[model samples]
Target: MQPWFVYRKCSNRSCDMCIYFLVLFASVCLQVQIKREKALDITSEHLIKAMADQMANEGWRELGYVYLSIDDCWTKKQRDPNGRLEPDPDRFPSGIKALADYVHSRGLKLGIYSDMGNYTCGGYPGTTLDTIKTDAETFSSWEVDMLKFDGCYSNDTEKAIGYPKMSSALNATGRQILYSCSWPAYEGGLPPKVNYTQLGNICNMWRNYGDIQDSWASVLDIIKWYAVNQDVLQPTAGPGHWNDPDMLITGDFGLSYEQSKAQLAIWAILAAPLIMSNDLRTISQEAKDLLQNRLLIYINQDSLGIQGRQIMKVDCLGVWKRELVNGQYAIAVINMGDDGLPRPFTTSLGLLNVTQCPVGYKLYDVFDRNYLGLFNSETTFNLKINPSGVVMLFIQPASVVNHMKRHGSYFG
Candidate 1:
């Protein structure tokens, strides 16, 4: 070649050769566009009307899988002799189809429960010995929007057979229903050899943990595990498919107001599905406010499903942060340990690659709706965080750094 095209100026003084590696690298790596999906899991026992009303009022368009889902009581001692799935009339008085229609009328989708084994978790009859096609067709006929498949009585072989069988049946119906695999994460079902990526393609979301109890400790423990395991399951999460973290415990489950806020903040940061498990009809004002925090909800619904991670830890003062796709940063300064003197914590923008060591950025406290003044060479701020409380921030590019020293601070 006579001459090489150079797109970027050479920075090294000793180099004279025209380099095009950066351009070539950029051209080779294609950016994959991903869509994000918001979901809420509700039990059948929850007040369906109230949940629908609240979701509609709060601007939540999608009412994920609405059925106080028949955890175990929605079945008889056994299936019918004709191999048809039976419904407990006592619980579902209007029948499954009528219930689905009612949910649909309220602009919500109905999700039901099933097991791959002979019985469900609550000992109800499952589709183990029955035809998968028929069971799936039944659900479709009932207008079921989602299915939560349990592996309670399923053996290792059944686990392999049950999921695929149900998937094929559901697909055959030509109805779009979200399929959720409820296999515990610690279980031996998921592995690289089993090709979980393919499974993810078939199911909308899969549960990696058991039922999340209603306690701060339980919630924190599950969140911690998800933070550590997110990278491992990243390939299986996106618009249609997500790594489910179970339902939310924010509304009146015996958690303190501070604890509920912490839970909501953490769940939003994790990008977990926003499923409410409490009785929405009788919830308190504080509980409703915690659930209806739109600012935090937006973070969870960000197109990029990048979960936040703990950036720095100062004993009980834990700082977690995430980078949004819009060149913004979401930070959570939390105090999870014992309540001592209010501790001050700072998060550096340098850690998020937004700026180099010699440059700094500006941050806006989204929660408090206040501006944190800029710092030179690094975006650093201090906040007094109490136990089980959090201070959330959104970091943006420094407006003052762009040649105008007159602008005091644009964070507000």
Candidate 2:
């Protein structure tokens, strides 16, 4: 079988991992808008700046969590007198340019939100074809590093035209702003409706499913959708492009500890973007550890960039595997049962598609950070996966490690 060559290493300064956080601060403001709270204490500038500061202070910046994104409701309900979009004076007194400057000073990139329709999802002014050039230029001028263009209040025709138009418009500005599109998600996220080739040509990443709500069921739904659509989605994802399953709500409400690990592990296997939609200010320590797990992040950002596939699924057990550079592989076994007990599962290297391991395969339990000993093609391994949980392992062939060491190249 030919290995899917969708991933390339990002050589640009900030695009290395492109790990980002769609701050839950934006979610809170959206809730405030729905509740009609006009005078919230956390201003847009404060919220975004605080997130950037936390990334810097908490070591998240070093982990490649560099893009700090501001979602909807950051703008005034009305455009300025000149028709250019303006930040809400009360919420963003310092203005977006200044905020972008601040984020950049911390070595972080700033991502802003907008819609390709008459109005944003929150009913703020959106960018139409007429305003696409102006909005793109404005964002570039502000040094915005990323744009999360949403699909709201727009029909299919408008999206088809506007999405690529905006991509071209952003390119015309001469700034390298990452385009995060919601096109596929709105167009059923399937082959007939979504042109994966065209999407890869234009977008840096795309949402391919419904918004991930804060629930175990929501996570499972996304996992199932991506797993079922892996063949189509995997081939299009690589260094510059990715299939976004929406935000990681792991650190937020509605997930248990094991469930959080499952979300993180599977997202890594899928090579999906690790955009956290949780409140960084008050996230629990356990949740924070999972979010900042370096081993998982390494797998997710592997240069090989091969999106994992569901090797097998039977009853409550689902297995996934992603190929990595240096002949390494990642395997994730998830228990989707809700029976409140660990499900015992058994499998071997041969079943996992390991055709050959000349000196046996050394397995490392990434979640527990333990060495699980060496095994071969027929070596059987047993796992007791907790309900609503996952166990992820990294497989490295001993022969490859020995060969690399003989050649004086570091394999670890």
The positional error of residue 52 in candidate 1, measured at the CA in angstroms, is: 3.6
Tens digits of per-residue lDDT, candidate 1, 314-346, equal 787766777665565677777777654566775
Best candidate according to TM-score: 2
C-alpha TM-scores of all predictions: 0.76, 0.91
Whole-model lDDT per candidate: 0.59, 0.81
What lDDT score goes with residue 71 in model 2?
85
lDDT of 2 by residue, 197-315 (tens): 88877788899988888999999999988888888888888777888888888778899999999999999898888888877889898888888776677778776677889989979
Off by over 4 Å in 2: 1-28, 32-39, 400-412
Give the Å error, residue 241, model 1: 1.6
Candidate 1 Cα misplacement greater than 4 A, ranges? 1-50, 53-70, 184-195, 339-342, 356-362, 369-377, 397-412
